[model samples]
Target: MGETDKHRRIMTALIEALIAFFKNIAGVYVSGNLMLYYEEGNPSACVSPDVFVIRGVGKNERRVYKLWEEVNAPDVVIEITSRSTRLEDLGNKRALYAELGVAEYFIYDPNQEYLKPPLQGYRLAQNDYAPIAPDAQGKFHSAILNLDLQIVNDNLRLFNPHTQKFLLTPLEAQEAVEQAETENARLRAELKKLREEK
Candidate 1:
């Protein structure tokens, strides 16, 4: 309820990029702001993450993810953080993810005022979580997702170093298509004029 506009925007962007990037991959499920019930029948042992990815599972929608039934906890979990949730995100949530054996845990403070670096990550190792060190460019590499997590212009961004491009959100993808169409139309007109002149 206390989520800001930036938090919501970042969450949506992550969700869009994850879907677009992983849609063709088999057994990859991405979701946001969903209840992950760790205990099979105990509703109280649940955590609602801002964004999560579970591998080796069907990509179908679920009202709530039951870990026992799925046989896998989220491989990656990301939180769009705020000052109010700082304690929870860094403390309880961190412990819970480690306990659940989430391979990667990331938190991004889009506002830039809450966290010192505004982006941080942890990787589960030997049942304990280890800090994920940022690279020279300040991007934290996600081995599970095979992507780099960073902040771009005050927003959480996923960059694919392999493609040498940042994964686009849904709106950004739409804008790219529109821009390409416009450029193509202009080039077509110019080509017709050149042919007529010749």
Candidate 2:
């Protein structure tokens, strides 16, 4: 089923932010809305997650995720769920991710369709999933990525705990650069005026 525009935007932003954050690190793969085939022959054992990250595997382009070939399942999975996919995201898909050894699974409801708090995280422990508790500010930490996940203004965002900074999307990063350029130009003009007055 096709997702809402907001859902698509959120997924794209997250994928871009994650790629920007982890691009320098080797063996970290970030992908979005790709078919994950767990079984070799049987096509039924497949699922397409909104965004996922797998570590320790060489960063390479793949048409579809093949668990057998990769030798590892996604360490983290984020599902941008809505009213239509809420049930699957919370139930069957959740269980499937756990069974596949996904270290952390997060589900976010951008539209506030039905999920309470709109963000939830779970950690795989002992082959079972345990609820990932939130911090004082209600941010869930992803141990796999060493980053914190939170909802800001009803949008799912990633935060770097170590840096105490939120990961900026590509658009946000570009805007930041432009703002810096504008500030530098203003400062240069002020300095020129001061030199002339001197």
Candidate 3:
């Protein structure tokens, strides 16, 4: 349709891709543009994070997440920088998430104009979020999720330290499990043949 609609669609696709990728990993939940209601003064003031994660939340697709229903704010909230929303994301949105007691805050600039390299992270301390140190590779670790945020090949990717592997999507995780089971069965059969020969 219009240019704005096209941009929104593109962003939505990107968000969905990231969420799907992160869901393949165990103990992580990624949501995008999920409405987070806070105050009652103005419904329009509701916040929808571009991307967020809550570890150990289990694997499931959610149509929408209500803050009051979830009983906890997201552990990590990521904001995708855009021309119209860059200022708000860096300012009001940051303050709002901090006041809500979110554990971590991340900002990314897909345009790569204002925020070059396009990734920043902050960890909540006491009543506010303090800047977090990025690793030598310019990747930031999430204390809450225990994952690293890295820009790989111009796209933000989630790195799982426990598995020392990049998290996969739901389908990928399923396939991986199946593949492992098949390999294990093959090895077991080979071992049985060897024992018989002995």
**Candidate 3 local lDDT, 1-198, one digit each (tens):** 122453354346545645665646886777777777766555675788877776656657776665665666778788777778889988998899889888899887765776755788988899787988898988899877677887776566678788887655445568888999999999999999999999
Q: Judge candidate 1 against the unseen true structure and give its global Cα lDDT, from 0 to 1.
A: 0.92
Stronger candidate by lDDT (1 vs 3): 1
List TM-score per model, in order: 0.92, 0.91, 0.69
Instruction: Give the lDDT of residue 196 in candidate 3.
Output: 100
On residues 1-198, what C-alpha lDDT tens digit does candidate 1 reach at each position? 557777888898899899989999999999989988998768899999999999999999899889889998999999988878988999999999999999999998887888888899999999888989999999999999999998888778999989989999888899999999999999999999999999
Q: Across residues 1-198, which tens digit of lDDT does each residue of candidate 2 receive?
A: 798889998999999999999989999999999999999999988999999999989878889989999898999999998888999999999999989999999999898768987899999999888989999999999989999999999889999998999999878999999999999999999999999999
Alpha-carbon lDDT, every model: 0.92, 0.93, 0.74
TM-score of 2: 0.91
